[model samples]
Target chain A: MDALLIDPVLARACGSALAVILLLGAWQKLRDMAVFEAAVELYRLLPDRMVPLFARALPMLEAAAGAALLLESTRGIGLVLALVVLGISTGGVLINLLRGHTDIDCGCGGADGNTRLSWALPVRNAVLMLLAVAGAQAGLARPLVWVDFITVAGGTLALLGIYAAGNQLLANHPRLMQLRNGS
Target chain B: MNEALMISNALLWVAVLAALIGLFALARQIGVLYERVAPMGALMIDTGPKVGEPAPSFELPTLTGNARVRIGGAADKSTLLFFLSPTCPVCKKLLPILRSVNETERSWLRVVLASDGEQPEHLAFYEKADLKPFPYLLSQDLGIGFHVGKLPYAVLMDEQGRITAKGLVNSREQLESLFTAKELGVASVQDFIDHQHDHQRA
Candidate 1:
């Protein structure tokens, strides 16, 4: 296994470098207005039954994933974060292709300029996955602890609360309306 | 007084315990739904507001259509909404299918054919379908809020104005798969269409 075989110092170096690239990538994505718009478009395409709760939580996670990748202390944390980002991006596009709705762009990581599904996306991910595998091997994280589960459970619940409140706020306040209207 | 009251109190506690169990189950279901929706943002379509979202309240003044009707109001009934355009050809195919459903489903549901034209040609299409007396509302009031880009769009709402359904109501099976029932039937547009097809064949 790469974890057992790879040098920890080398792995850490690789992870730190990958983290910089990912953080820069995430920053670009965060800066692009259209990336956010694409996300909203995606939100619109979802079935009514599933929209409300997701519309809030996913964006926040993405924002965090980008931010955490740059920090040196969160080196191993960054790999896990990168896995989540790549896994969802690669998998979601493939699933959407299967679902028969292909008009929209994949919009992966500030990818507004890229129109077509190219070799770049999967290639980027494959490399990231390798880097993450190396770091994960070095870090040798244990299986999810009870504390981790509790944390995710608490986080998920907190996400739900935030969504509920945001929906209510968007409903009652016209400031959300202003955002909708390009203000 | 002491013994009889003690027995009554025990029964009360049992009832309370059962309610808590039911509520916990409901919370778990909500959690599961939350997990499903997260991270799949690009796939969701704009429904009148959104599905599971509280529908926006609006009533439009029409020159050709009948009186203004309130959408997303707690009218104490179920409503099937269509955010449609006169020029949309898909909507032309969808209307008859909906009318047939409206006829078969009866008074349990009301279809509101919402359109956003200040023109007469658009109103003429409504005259053609007749909508089985479905209330057609104009959308001059809230075009940006509704995100009226496409046609043949539809939504289902509860008595409380939260969307039960949205997007192109494609098939009876798809709707049935999406629908969940509790307490009373808010009715389903999917079942209504499928049964109507079944009835016509029968």
Candidate 2:
């Protein structure tokens, strides 16, 4: 039963779902830059050097992802990016949950003024992963969607740029010693 | 002792929970973890909670302050008892939001904050959050059945005062059902949702 609930299959499923959420999230974040912007502000919770880079690039990275997911050509590329995003985001949630930081909201909501923290957030991502897997399996036969390709690619780049800056900021901040382990 | 040694604050403890879950998650992938622990987990999870049976109750020690009580003792309104500690940053973050739940609903909740420290710390917490109006309790028992080993456990009771849900209450839709039932005298599940929708539209 425990195996049934928390099984390797579930973890894999979770990972896949994470992929969907992250890819989609990366795109939404690109357009709004709100949470990423807040996360950048949280850079002070990290270090000094990473802030400038994070604040400047995160929005663009998300925008790129939006492009990739929308474009049919880069669907595969976008899916890969989605998996990576979920891995990081899941790690963040687990880390916070364990460390007793439950108040923190999942950082996936887009730039719009939505303050949602529904159960759907996680489940939706999981479904997305299944779709990603389908998309991957059908990659060869799948038709093209240039808009998705452009959006996802764009979001990926935007996220990468922001993440780099964010990491650096955490590395520099002296007071945010807790972030030193880079959890 | 080892757990104590590693843990210093509520935030750190939550991080530990995540890390530990991650370990189990990773272990399941590797097969090393499951080969050893799956049997034990199955036994524990299966016999633990079920329907048509009265739910278990708990009296836990507050990990961050001075107060304690046993929740789910029969009452008029079904109680949605939750255990959280101030030292836990997660709990702290949730406090302000919970404080406001009463204005929307007619208060089917009796939030019992269980912590693991002295009165001063608890007092400090009350002052910090300005939660003087809420009921607080101390738990020396470490919130065993209330899910203190993991932090942030909640239990719900029906109007008949029977346990409807316990341990973790993350299912927003289901949890809301209990609240709706308590808020309105409506009995059925669909009725509550329909009424809620009407209320929303109205």
Q: Which prediction has the highest lDDT against the true structure?
A: 1
lDDT per residue, candidate 2, A48-156, as tens digits? Answer: 4664465445434544544555455675676676555545454554555555544333445532221223333345456455544543432222344543343334343
Per-residue alpha-carbon lDDT of model 2 for B29-146, expressed as tens digits? 4333222222211211213344224445665444343555455556655555656655333354455556655434444456545555468767776675677656566654424343
TM-score of each model, paired residue for residue: 0.35, 0.39
Tell me the lDDT of model 1 at A78. Answer: 63
* C-alpha RMSD over true interface residues, each candidate: 14.7, 17.1
Docking class of 2: incorrect
* Candidate 2 stretches greater than 4 Å from native: A1-183, B1-43, B46-68, B83-97, B114-133, B136-143, B146-153, B158-161, B171-174, B180-202
- Model 1 lDDT tens row, A1-183: 655446444454445445554555555554544333434345235664454444344545555654665455665566677788778666765665566544344444331122333344466567667766664444444554444443333333333333233223322222222233542
What is candidate 2's local distance difference test score?
A: 0.46
The local distance difference test score of model 1 is: 0.52
For each candidate, the alpha-carbon lDDT, in order, equals 0.52, 0.46
Q: lDDT at A163 for candidate 1? A: 29
